[model samples]
Target: MSTAPHLEAGGLLLIADESLSPALVEQAAPVLAQGGLALCQGPGSPSGPRRLVLFDGKLTPTHAEALRGEPPALLLATRASDGRPSTWEARLLGDLLRGAPLLPAGASRHRLQSVADISAAGGAAARAVTQAGGSRTAAALVADVVHELAANAMWDAPVDSRGQHRYAHRRSEVREVAPEDACELAYAVEEGRMWLEVVDRFGGLRPGPFARALGGWG
Candidate 1:
């Protein structure tokens, strides 16, 4: 709903439907302008790179599918009937528009195997973040998030020929992550934001699980 004071100007494009309430637009205008972005209301598509198309209503599955191949980053904003953003919707928009890296430049990346490797990668990322002027709390939070991401990639991602998760039953115990099942960890700090990403080679995340997680069903 509001922009962070320390955010650096970054290129952004917000596309909202004409049906969106003027009140909502008024609330979002300053935040969008503060981020150095342009906002357009209409059905017409705009041209350019680093543009983020923001759907300013409930994003149905069919609508999401239709926009799958569209150019530019797609961010959905689901608002209540009264035109107020839900907590998750607000957070998602804040993260996207806060000038953080979509992909960090000059990031430190590591191929991590085993719990020890996860720890090392997190420590390295924390150091990088702090050296870039991130607060100690931010560094610690980034490190913790990286650790959890790495753990999920290592212990919950392997699939077998029968389509069963190889380590699902053993999630509670620590186990060595084989080199073949290793995950990639990358992190960087830019413009007062710390960016962290974990990549699992299996690419086995399904929509059902993702939806459930998002809905806090687990």
Candidate 2:
């Protein structure tokens, strides 16, 4: 997302060359509709619920032609700003392709109902990871993600009836989240994979603003 250009059109999530024709998406519908992801290659984005993947981030014309359907693509991002894809990106794509459930059902879960709980969750993550035979580095990473997602859920996701952020500005101050405003964090560690999930009760956040965040009814 930081470097690769992405587009949301025709219910497709396009991730390809800026030079690629918009017509490429014209033929594709929402491939993610079926809840299963398709890894399409070459042009003609999957007409159904499938996602197109490009091997090269610096897509040449042929690569561009690979664009067809936008099925929640997860490109390998070869040569992103650096010579290789970011570790998280590579790991994420690897995880999805490996077919493991993004959030396993047996994961340990935690809740954050107050700002104080955010820091506590991070500590719990590190301890849990270590107990599960994970390295401190791995533990640190998951803990950080947990911290962030908790913050976003509590502060970034809330919107009031007037469509204003309920507590975004007060993010700097410590406070308790009302029971209804609480967020959940869950994690699971498999032999080779680690998964983290954060659930905010409010789907109140939008892409950029309160109106769009509130959806069409806003």
Name the top TM-score candidate.
1
lDDT of 2 at 26: 24
Q: Report how far residue 78 has shifted in candidate 2, in Å.
A: 6.9
Per-model TM values vs. the true structure: 0.58, 0.57
Model 2 residue 40 CA deviation (Å) reads 7.9
Give every collision pair in model 2.
Answer: 31-49, 31-50, 42-66, 43-66, 45-68, 45-69, 51-71, 206-213
Q: Write the per-residue lDDT of candidate 1 for residues 143-183, one digit (tens) a residue.
A: 89998888888888887778788776887675676678888
Candidate 1: the clashing residue pairs are none
> Count of backbone clashes for each model?
0, 8
Worst 10 residues of 1 by lDDT: 1-10
C-alpha positional error of residue 160 in candidate 2 after TM-score superposition, expressed in Å: 0.8
